[model samples]
Target: MKSPILRLDTMKFTYISLLILVSPILFLSCKGKFNFSKQKAENEKIVVQYGEHFLTDRDLKLILPKDYTKEDSVNWVKTYIEEWVKKKAIVDKAEENIDELTLKEIENKIVEYRQDLLINAYNNYLIEKNIKDSVTDEELFQYYEKHKDSFPLVKEVVQFRAITVDKSEENQAERLFNSSKDEDFDEVMKMVLQAGNAYHDKDSIWYSPEYIAAQFPELNQNDQLSQLISRRKVKISDENTVTLIKILNLKPKGSTAPYEFVKPTIKNLLLNKRKLNLLSELQNQLYKEAINKNEIKINEN
Candidate 1:
C-alpha cells in the first residue's frame, strides 16, 4: 500500500510545467507508459494550481486507492489534475464576471452541499463503527427463500463450454469434444486445448444466453439458446474460426437466481435495511426527547 508519489519535491512544478509534462503524452498514449519518476525537483510536486490554491500529490493520494500501480496512479493524477484546473479556472472566472447577488446564491449552494456531505459522511461512519456488516449464510438463505420472487432470473442463463479453433480444425475439434468419455471438465478442457486456440470451460459458472449467442452466432441458427440443453453439441463456423459449443444446463427466465451468485447483493441490501431502521429509531427517539423538553412546537392553524 505504498504511495505512488515517490518524490514529494517533483509535485512543486509550476502550472506551465504541469501543462508541458501532461500535453505531449496526448500525442502518444499507451498502456503502462505513464511514469513520473524522472520529474525530480528540489521543490514539492504541485499537481494543480490556480493563484494560491495548490493540489499536490499527497492531496490526490487521499482519493486514489492505495493498491493502484505506478502506471495507473500516474494516469489518475493526470486526469484529476486536469479536472482541478478546469474547475478552478471556471469558478475564478465566475467570481470575477458574475454579480454580487448571484455570487451570494452560489455561496449558499456551496454551504448546503458541504452540510449534506458532512451529514452523509458522519452517518456512514456511525454505520461502519456500530453496525454488524456481515450477513451469515443462514440469514442470506432465509432472506432469499422469503424473497425469491424479488430475485427472479430476467435473462436466460446456461452453463456451457465454448471451444473455438481454426477453421481447418473444426471437424476434428467437434469429434474430440463429443467423443470424450472423461467426467471432469478439466479433462475435457485439456482435450479441447490440444486442438483449439481458446475455450470457455468453466462448467460451474453460468453465463447469459446473450453472451453464448454473441460468442457463437451459430447458436442462433434455428432455436435460441434457452431451448438447448447439455446433451446438445453445436458446431459453428465463421470465415476464420470454428466454434464448438456444448450446453451443459439451461435455466430460463422467472426461475429464482442462484443464491451463491447473489450473496454479496443480498448482504448489501440487508445492511442498507439495517441502516435505515437505525436511522428511523434515532429520529424517533430525538423527537420524543424534544417534545418532553418543550423544544418542539407545532402550531397547526
Candidate 2:
C-alpha cells in the first residue's frame, strides 16, 4: 500500500535507529569485567591520620624503612603525612612564577634523595636486627673492677717528669731559680700544649689524688716539701734552694661511680658498638653476595 521509494526510506531510517540503540551495548560487551574484589581490597587498606592529613598503607610502604613492624609503620606514616602536608602548604604559598624546568629538576633531586634514604633505612634495619641487651650487671661490675682505673673522674691527674731549672748552671741541682731556656725542650713543651697534652699510656695516668698521696705519703705529709712540689700552695722551704713546683695534672677523689650514673650511657654505647659490628658483617655479606652474582661493576676511566 506504500510507494517503493517511501518503503526504502523507511527501512533505512529503521536500520539507523537500530545502530543507535545497539552501539553502546556492543561497546560495553567488549569491555573487561569490573573488578569489585580488587577495588574492595584496595579500599580495605589501613590508613594513618594526622590532623587533616591522611596516608594509606600503600603510601607508607613507599616511605617506610625496611623491616619496620606494623605499629612502627603506622606511626611513621602518620608523621610522614603531617610533614608532607606542611611541605605542601608551604609550596602552595610559594610564588607561582617558579619555572616548570626548575620544578622537574627539584623532583629529580627528591627522587635521588629518596633512593639514598632507602639504602640508609636498610642499613638501619640490619643494625636493629643485631642489637642486643647483652651486657649484664655482673658483667658491668666486672668491667668496672678490671678497668676501675679506667673510669677516671672528670678531673684527671697525671704523674709526669719535669726538668726543674735552678739559677746556677754549674750546680743545676740546687740553687736560685734558673731563667735560661732549653730551646729544644721548650719546643717540645710547646708541641705538647698544641697536642692537648695527649697521654701516651693510659696506665701511667692515675685517677685518685688520694692514691697518689698515699704512694708518696712522706712527701705529701711534709707540709714544707708538699708545698715545694706540685702542692696546692707554694711555700719557700729554705733561702739557698728555691722550690720549683710543677703539677702534671689534678686527680679528684675516686669512688664507685653510681650505677645509675653510667648505666644508661654505657648501655647506649655498647648497643651502638654492637649494632655497628653487625652492620659491618651485613655489609661484608652483601658485598660477597653481590660479587658472586656479578651485581657490582666498576668502570675504568
Best by lDDT: 1
TM-score of each: 0.51, 0.33
lDDT of 1 by residue, 1-301 (tens): 4554443333334334545675442223435634443343455455554453555555765667667865566666677777766776677788899999999998899999999898678778779887765567899899999987788888657777777777776665566676656554455466557764778868778778777778766667767453455446666677988767887777777888877656778999998998888778877988899999999778998
Candidate 2, residues 229-280, lDDT tens digits: the string is 3453232233332233334444444744444445566677667777777767
Model 2 steric clash total = 1
Relative to the unseen true structure, what is the C-alpha lDDT of residue 21 in candidate 2, on a scale of 0 to 100? 45
Cα lDDT over the full model 1 = 0.69
What is the lDDT for 159 in model 2?
44
Query: How many angstroms is residue 48 displaced in model 1 relative to the true structure, after the best TM-score fit?
Result: 13
- lDDT score, residue 15, model 1? 32
Of candidate 2, the 10-residue stretch with the lowest lDDT total is 169-178
- Which pairs clash inside model 2? 167-176
